[model samples]
Target chain A: MKELLEKIFENIYSNGLSEERYCDIKEFISEKLISEYNDYVMNREIVAKNKVNTLDIVLPNAKVGDYYSQLLKIEDEEIIEYWIEGLKKTGLEVVSEIVLDFQKEDNTMVQGSANLEVFDNDNIECQKQVIGTKNKGLVIKGNPIMSGDFDLTLKYKYKGWFDGCNILERKLRFAINPDPRSLWKDIPTDKNIKFYKDDFVSEYVTVLANDKGLQKDIVAASKRGRSHAHEGKARDDDFKLYHNDENGWYIIAVADGAGSAKYSRKGSEIACETSVEYCKQALQMPTELEETILELSKAEEGYSNRSISTLIYNIIGGAAHKAHRAILDVVKANEDQVRDYATTLLLAICKKFDFGWFVASFWVGDGAMCIYDKERQYIKLLGTPDGGEYAGQTRFLTMPEIFTPESIMSRLKYSIEEDFSALILMTDGVSDPFFETDANLNKVEKWNELWENINKEVDLTDDNSESKNQLLNWLDFWSAGNHDDRTIAILY
Target chain B: MRRLPVYLLIDTSGSMRGEPIESVKVGIESMISTLRQDPYALETVNISIITYDRDVKIIFPLTPLDELQLPDIVTPDSGPTHTGAALEKLCSQVEKEVKLSTPEQKGDWMPLLFIMTDGHPSDIMIYNQVIKKVKQHNFASIIACAAGMKAKVEPLKQLTNEVYSLDTMDSSSFKKFFKWVSDLIEVGNKSIGATDELLLPTPPEEMNRII
Candidate 1:
């Protein structure tokens, strides 16, 4: 049983679906057990009938199948012994029990005992008692002879009234060189164990910052990161980069498609594209509002910062509305659901002001935008996450609030800052690994750690052509075991 | 990374002997097969089954559907409805099984529970205590289904706000109810990390009514 299990685990790690691996194991055990039972029945046909008749003479209508079923029943300790002997024949030493501590409190690998069981062909064990109090991953104990695999079978009793026993099988496969950040904690460093990676890592430049005529190196990059889907999810989160050198303005917009949404990838692509286009159009708006926007921030009267804030608000708010309408248009034409294209939007436009730089940022939902200053060496978060009624629930660009002015004012968040180093925009996929939650978004160390990690992948000190490719590649780094699509855009 | 664990507490006293028991078995199997078809549910949902007769039995521990086998549920020959014992067992299981989040690690999704019964509890006082204990587990959702003519609703109301009474106890009604539960689970799989209670699929008005 041990050798067969080890071989199956190896095959599963090499090239087999976990689902099929389980099915294959089950088939093997059933065949072996049934074949053994068949041999026993065939060998003692006359002796079994004579012994059964002597043991129960009153039994008038009992067939050979009934006798065999009774003998194989879980309630019969002798049948269990036969299974143990079968396991022994397969070179597995059976123990009374073994324990499993899912919460390895001591951070130790080995701890408890486990009970063994055998199914048709899949030899595994059903967990006897789960005593973990916290949410740690698999931990096996009780010195077993097996390496790279463990087997436990459930002992389900079958009555004479029932036809067959109901047994379940479970097998554990640990990764050989597991990532320390893996959610599956404390994986043993066994040579045979290997993390399931169907897709090999590849390098490519999806987008790069195009500095045609700018004051400084405006670094911006976006790439489809590793996700639940290997070759990139059918729908990837998106970012739209806009460089309006004519207007002395640069815009970067990112949209994260909800994993649950069917057409969200398209929605994100459209949202980022539409939002950035609108921001460019907003800059093209008559300079008449600029004087009013400039005046309102200075005035301390009725609505201080209201005029300028409102002007920036209308640009972002109108852009959000356009994105929403665009999604609605797709839904209407396709006869699909608005929720199917649900996505979160984050847009930022930086204008090369005479003083330094005037930046206007807007967002609606999770993810984050930050202002990093090289001189001050500090990171400032633009806004808090608009986590809706639920953790996964967030305000989408397709929400009805995007249409109404009043609701849009309340729902949309806008911020303006000067004397900043760079403008950073990202989807939740990139933000979540560094910042566990929105509340932790302002943690400078977390941001610094991200910066350090990125530097490890790319030389940020030298802002050259290679920096763009390096940033795009760096965006694909695996972190915190989250495989969601990642997108980040920066005007540095 | 964490699975969404769902618990099913079933009552299998003497009264649920023939068609009712068989229908339930078939209904549960159908639910499993249906849930398996959904990609999100297939990746995340883990199910546990516990049955109560004169005593409580954990037919299956929480397990992912990929590795699950549909167990044969048998009706006891003659035993009282030990619903209290079942509730107590559920409370203990919740404590033993539910994972809590730590500073460095995210926890399992809040567990969802379903209690199905056809008769009144033989031990009311004990049932009340266990129900209160179960509530402290802070389950994501708790739904109770009262079936058959003798099944009452008032007791179930105390356990959870999501209580439904089957209009009739038959194979078809059982089938519909199970399908509703399966659909609800599938929808839940899409938003497993939501803080608010999910918008569950409504049960058929003709076959089941809210308490």
Candidate 2:
């Protein structure tokens, strides 16, 4: 530990800080270290305090008032209360009138009068409520504090669900949502935690669900289809969906892992996640300048949308390279299992434009990407799959050739158009069952019929969550004895 | 999405009755168990076993690894090694079972054939006929393993270029051969629908290459 700290200090000193700035450096170091230490300690405390129920609250896997009655048990905890207090400090808007409720084991209510308030500066704004034992709703006195810590105090006695007569006093503390935008910037180095989505989704679910600029609805899902031999093993296909509402951009990446690879599933997962992350970064690039460059370049060339398309193609291509590098990182870290992580990648990025949308897709394997226009009622195939010069062979992203910009550009396909309806990106597992070959992918009737079937089978008009679940279930639709792992990502 | 068909033909003549037979049994079992652990093999490989002593026996037909149960090999007390009968059975089975690709459906991948023996075959003419049939079509790949000293490579060479001569028919050699088989199946499973030829591993250091 000492050696590590000495190395860090040595590196900092090597940055050429003079003795005259010693006081300023000391203050900066103190503030930075204190903040980091606090964050580390606070995160640990929060995990330790609500280890059992934190995942439930953070993920909210269950819905209230559904066919199944959801059980929510808030325990007496210090961090939850302290974190509530921290949120008020961030000065974000918070809804007033926080409520608390107690319920019995068998969905029975316990009637009692309970008071909730935000005691800021000793000003107690008490919102009184009659808490029913069976259930109660507490509306916190403000909109969710976007970023920061906040504290809350709960004084309540509930009859034990198991014991029936013993009264239990509970207090809870919870930190408000942290800045979700950081998730795009901080790529996890740990392999096991790199693909974890609980925290990321909990923080950004609202932003992802927000369809402010999107002209239509988007539905996406993935599933492990039936295995020809093993009943329980997953098919080697994975996908990712990423959307940045503020940036008005969404990315869908799907990878079909090489069945020959022992850890192809891991490769597919890392590929999708890393590619989406890179695309998120690409979305931040100055596109206006790119457009200006394209416009000037277009004057020298023909009237084709080649320049703009090239820009979009390059962005998507660059993201694919980043994903390839991430996979290589995994391979290099564990050379013994180098071939285990081979997989094919397909990435598509779409951003809303004034007329329609600017869309680009890049692929280096056998999968299908289709763009369906609701207005024109036409379906377009983005590009052909890289089926190798053999009957059953295709290239994997792990191959070194795709790492170069030239090769990536050669593989990319793009479009800048109006009347954009929906984008369908899928691994071969799902695509194979639907369309046996790439030649059948662009059949307008088939695409339209598929959408019609989906509309009939799934409730897409009401809730996006329901549609997502339905799509996931739809992936399990078996046909032609083609049992493989299936993954599909849709943007509409 | 097509299944990769794998056929294993083992010689269970009187010569392989002792420790060699037991080793072969253990090896086959271990290979299946290992293949079951791989997600790719479990999902794609459909294996079949054909054992020949005096008479060929189809112990098990093409069955997926998930539902397949490795059967016990019972070699006859005294019988000539009829490898030709086993090859004939395999040829007939492939013709009967392997589906040809059609407009409506994709057929199974080219079959992977592994022929293992401890002695020379009694009926060489039939074996030559089966080899001719296999050569006419694109069988994924074929491997012939000559196990005991009595096993001749010249007879096996007529069947495949990928022929190996095990120095001794001991338990270790049998184990190494089966381990190679398991690894080869895994490679074959991964390459299914993605590559034309089976991507088999190099023979273990103990085994000798037979031209």
Candidate 3:
């Protein structure tokens, strides 16, 4: 993308030097600001529709292509579609489709936007500053082909052939879409909790820690951090809200986007938001997780076309299903449900640093995780990362190939610096390919590299263009036709 | 809250045509909305539903008042009512959930199962096995109600002797029956832990005036 941007800039700089002076970003934003104003006004009138100024919508001639270059003004602004890669800009019956990848959390990625418009504010025709949690857009368009009578689609001709690549790694970005009080501990609660020490058990070991020591480490996961994911994933998945009212509180939220069923994503959303709600209710409404799991199971048994999502939060301290009878059993019976009834389970809490951290994470289907805080790197926490079964084996919540507490491998001592900088998680999409085998140096090496890269920050010494370019450069490096929607949350 | 799981077994057989089914739907929705208004019912009564025709379908799982939407009850488009299979299916469903229950759930015993039908089981052998299984799980209390002129009573007796014949099979009678059920549930909940037996409303002759 950087190369393409550079090429476009160079091409304009060389051939179109005459009309190019007016083509700078200052001119663009100014033009965009006007359109933003119109978008704001148009949206407001749309609520009452008839009162707004209409555009003389036009579809570009198939033959005109990029051969004709001019801006059309509607309500006073410009809309442009550039042919970054394709044949002649015009005459190429361009098919534009809108896909919004809405996750269990509500993290949405509206790719190849159609129904494009400048996002607006209240008076409807005005634009707001793009800072804080302001609703802004770089580009967006795509409304369903609702009526035969609709706006024209513009076609753009391109310079080269684009090769679609097989996914290197799969990255799923989840956003939280619940009320702030729902996920984030923003909602005030009056319930009080008593913290007590207990003998903690892992797969192969048991650690007896004092009460105070355990609380400190677990609190670490609860702290919010700055990441593009935090916002987008939060907006998509309610799973991000993992905080509490008092005591050393940390939370773990998990949402499983049902892969098979229709509207299963909503199920995932319900799981995360309600987990927090149910957990908070654990105070005065002290219902045990095991009981909640059982109730949730009973509640979901025969409801068809409805997906199941389970969110398990360890508020006081952390726990990993230790009993022979699996504490939780979240199901999606068949392919139809396996896809949408895709349930994600999360375990989290705040614990003492020396007593071991409060490890709160989720298991989507059967993807497993091995936490390496101390010694053993392959810390088998849950399911396999490949999301596959042994010898053509598969279990759809009806039958799950999960890590029963008995088969789980316990975590020992910390090997890395006591100063933990980042925590990483992967949807089976990435993990399966990464940890293929020993001497592969693929998963571990790549994770370490990606970790180090995301943690690094370019010096802020450069100008806005130069500095923004640095982030753009890294984004280019990490993303260059990777053919995967990669997302990672870094707790800074 | 003492949760009472209510399971509705409606005969979507060839017998229950038109008004009977529609009335049942309206009856359920009204019952739910009415229950929601009462704080205790809202907290305690959970409903699950099953429909039987050529096959058995668990239409609605046992869900708390809020989650239990009064389903749009539709008659079987075209099929025979295999009452036996439907009863067995209900048993299977109950067994799966009953074994998984814990202390957090509202009730320890089986839910109340209300089977309303105008015909006998398509297969008596299967029906007998289901009756025995349902009894073993103790997941549901069977209250078989005979509706319509040609009501089947003998096979229904196999499931439970607590059988009743509606005075007249009509939409109004269905409403009256469900409303009585709503009242019984209300009473059952208030008196939870006090009684294991359900509180049944009296017939018109037993009560001169309705409360």
Candidate 4:
């Protein structure tokens, strides 16, 4: 202890060091190898599987879209070997390694030594390898046709619902009633094109919602997002602006891409828009599984049969339908137009009445959903597995044909809370995160893995607005949240 | 003398914008400086800072009188209040960090966590699990505060014993809060008292209290 103090005294007396630099040295030197490996257990994943390059490191049973991996910390070389043995017991190739290091100062007595893991990849990248970062966001890559890209973004603020985790707003839109110019490149001029309402609706609402997220209003747009040099993506995904008594409430959406779809963005937008519209229509009077699913799916399918294969799972109750086809090889009416066009969907129906607020949801498929209750300690689960494959190393969701659930009921409820602010809807792209894989575990251990100790993370931010933005960016495998084409929508 | 491990859980969540955020950042530096100045506190108080803005980021793990350094944290623009996520992480982190400390290596007393949140969790519901983990470990006695956010105090009550609310967000209140926090640390270090004494500002008397 005296020697340690003497070294500190010398550094204090030294003329060539700043306190910040000194602190960094201590952090770099002291964090050791073991804890870092433990941290690796909560992150890592494969976001997009667009068939970009063949050398994409596909795990034995890994898929191209929506995969996750976690790293578990092991000490004794023998115990680690045994853990790997346990994994092999499951009859799968579990890749893992450990990193060791010793700390020293001025070549004196050793303080301690540590053995930790460098990195880990498992379960077809079904979970993000656990890691820590200075900035907030997930690290993931996907190929969305014509664009072979890797997405590295943070998940800022979010409103966790049964349907989807909504990313908070981050920009200015001058979203007023205006006219449209050239938004989409190849839109034939004569084919029912009206940009004015879309422009005005998008513009006015965005600005008003922007003000609502101001610092004075409890939450605000990310300062980094508004920085002059910032040219971050202006996502038109899962966003809508509504007004009440001259105040604006923006509704955002988060949708996951289907593993078997050629074009997921189209499915994502359709699911979000149609779900939001359905809830709006049902607001006057609520109905049931027969009306909500059969009728709603019919309505969406009626609109040119383009959305027939899309799963319409809503959280404000009334969410129904079969899980997928489960590799059984049976085509429905929706497949007549698009060959095996299917998507995993989850929806949230939120309505803030005089009695706190009420939101319910229903879901199916190998997706996920979470709800932060009024007490903050209670998180409700949504989008449980609907029986494609849920055992051993055999995970599901690679193709819509793998979905199969016959008798379906409503996995929905209503909450009586006055502080309600938002609703969220997402595709498997957003929901795939909850079903993660780790070095010590797999999808079969979902309940045992999260078991109380998993959701806890120390967020330093005091305002949720900033937190929301970070959540949006962090939902990837690398950033923080489960890796996927994370779309977060917050209604305030 | 009583040993107190003062864990500072700062909300680096992006919502804490501008000078207020800056002031909290500076306040962390000040807390370290002030704690270092007090010989008793310096000897007995162990400090660690866990910053969570977007992700549950641990700026530094728990360090004792032997190896301690005030970190250089770059304040980001935004972060998600994965408060529950952070807590869940801290549960494991604290357990791992504690395992590193033996009766001969560090103090044997339990750690104390001061969770300062200006808002609620961006990702909901999962915090229940986090809170349950924290309570299960009994690793630290939590002191939660709703700093600048129109925070959901009801939720804060579910996690800790001492939950305070700050009136009108500002730098002064933060400084004072830290001052009171440091004072408690000083007192706790100087004496063997189990309960630390903190001169905290009171919330509006009329505010409805949950716990």
Tell me, by TM-score, which candidate is best.
Answer: 1
Find the candidate with the highest lDDT and give its number.
Answer: 2
Q: What TM-score does candidate 4 reach?
A: 0.29
Docking class of 3: incorrect
What candidate 1 gets wrong by more than 4 Å, as runs, is: A1-233, A285-303, A374-377, A388-390, A402-407, A410-421, A461-472, A479-481, B1-3, B10-51, B54-78, B82-211
lDDT of 2 by residue, B1-211 (tens): 5678889998888888889989987787668666655555655688899999998999889987655655568877886778877877888898877755553455677778899987898888877776787776567789899987888899888888889989888888888899999988866654565334466788898788886
- CA displacement after TM-score superposition, residue A112 of candidate 1 (Å): 28
On the 0 to 100 scale, the lDDT of residue A213 in model 1 is 35
Supply candidate 4's per-residue lDDT for A124: 26
DockQ of each: 0.07, 0.06, 0.02, 0.01
Alpha carbon deviation, residue B186, candidate 1 (Å): 7.8
Model 4 interface CAPRI class: incorrect
Candidate 1 CAPRI-style tier: incorrect
A314, model 4: CA deviation in Å? 75
Which ranges in model 3 have alpha carbons more than 4 Å from their true place? A1-492, B99-109, B194-196, B203-211
Which model is ahead, 1 or 4, in terms of lDDT? 1
User: Model 4: per-residue lDDT, tens digit, A1-492?
Assistant: 447844885877676666787677667655754467445422211111111111122221111222324333322211111121112112223344333435542334345855343443444264433322211112222211111112122222211222332322211101010011111122222223211111101111223223333311111111111100111212212332232322221222233333223333234345445544545544434344223333333343224321211222232222222223221222333343232233434555543333334445544343444444333334445444342211111122223333333223334333334352223343333333444322111232443333322223212133343444444433322312121234433343
Candidate 3 interface RMSD value:
21.9
Local distance difference test, candidate 3: 0.41
Error of 3 at B163 (Å): 1.6
Least well predicted 10-residue stretch by lDDT in candidate 3 chain B = B99-108
lDDT of 1 by residue, B1-211 (tens): 5567899999899888888989898788778767655545655678999999898999998887655665568898887988889988888887777665443444566788999999888888899888878888877789899988789788888899898888677788888888999988866655443224666787887456564
Candidate 3's displacement at residue B85, Å, is: 1.0
